[model samples]
Target: MAISAPLNTALRAFAMLLFVVAIAACSRTPNAMPTGVGNLGPGGGAPGSQQEFLVSVGDRVFFETDSSNLTPTAMATLDKQAAWLNQYSNYRIMIEGHADERGTREYNIALGARRASIVVNYLTSKGVNGQRITSQSFGKERPVAICNDISCWSQNRRAVTVVQ
Candidate 1:
């Protein structure tokens, strides 16, 4: 026997309502941020998260022009980074070295490599495991600032630490 049209229509409407409710139940609220597996510790990020490292400590260190040597300021930043890495032992890091636009491509690559290596050495010396850190040289390929002046060049000459 066939159901009446009105009854059938009501049933379909009820099914649609249930489907919508189910979907809504599974979805997160608009303002809810996605969190990691464990508790959120300091710096407003989950423990060992990139957000934690960046927000609590710093992710980048600046260098002098044509220099791979870490300045006192850069060393200070590295000290913080090393401490963070030691605390967050589960995370691995990549050090990306960059250079100003004034150097030739080959020269810049070498400079950048030196810069990255120096950062890696510093971190390792500070008790961060050497195996957890890797380095790459971007040369003049990536620049946070672009201009023909010291201001921009200073910003470009740096190494950035990325957590993974």
Candidate 2:
């Protein structure tokens, strides 16, 4: 087969374009997660790494319908948070309690308070100082997920730990 000059020129241009793209891709570092910025693995790391707390310690824990009791899963998450808090002893935190929109304002506020208290107690038990923590109830006023469905309601019923 004989190759024409114009066809050879086009093939050479296409090959050059592909080589440039490959070089560009290799030079760029992926932003999957910042290096050494987040907790490397589950359970155990020094605090002050905001990325670690948000990604590993998990700032929020969910609860059952109309209940403030901590489930095993919730406890595990709280345990990790407590560990983080203990490591970062100088930091103070606020536990923000929230509720689904299924109850009256007053009722929800009370419920939220209870939930927040439970979280504080658990964290204290896990070696975090009670003095370093405070609690507030948002009731149904603030919700991370807003919808009438169970999925959204479940998300709204949570206690969030805000480190300050």
Candidate 3:
């Protein structure tokens, strides 16, 4: 019951230091990977998996309003997709075309179909087997971003590649 003043102070300091160290040990850096888990590679999926293809090779391409033509940027993404598809030939892909909620239902459906067909054609021309790819149109039935603004409309106009 009679600890010396110096001893008491030292013990308190030691406890404070331990607390600080424990907090530091438990805190993780923003970029630190989890322990015991090996690297998941790009996109956090096994190589050649659908997840890898979606993340690493990109799964979607945006289109201009009322246009099914592929822009240079879209072409670049498609190029990467073609390379990945070629490397993973066992996978079949379905290109889903979507249009912004601007035109009539029939018009949007036709536009979406054109968008999907364009992507299929591009991939086939790049050596991906046409037989391995199919295309469908969602038209305006599906909108990834549902708002009247241009931002949402732009996002809705896209073709997404689904790998099976």
Runs in model 1 deviating more than 4 A are 1-44
TM-score of 3: 0.78
The numbered model that scores best in TM-score is 3
Per-model lDDT: 0.90, 0.88, 0.91
Tens-digit per-residue lDDT, 37-124, candidate 2: 3335333334366666886679999999999999999999999898878888878899999999998999999999999999999999
TM per prediction? 0.73, 0.74, 0.78
Q: Rank the candidates by lDDT, best first.
A: 3, 1, 2
Candidate 1 structure quality by residue, lDDT tens digits, 121-143: 99999999999989999999999
Model 1 RMSD, rounded to 1 decimal = 9.0
- Please name the candidate that would achieve the greatest lDDT relative to the true structure: 3
The predicted structure with the larger TM-score, 1 or 3, is 3
Ranking by TM-score: 3, 2, 1
lDDT by residue (1-164, candidate 3, tens digit) is 89999999999999999999999988766665553223665465688887788667789999998999899999999999999999989999999999999989999999999999999999999999999998999999999999889999999999999999
TM-score of candidate 1 to 2 decimals:
0.73
- lDDT against true structure, model 1: 0.90
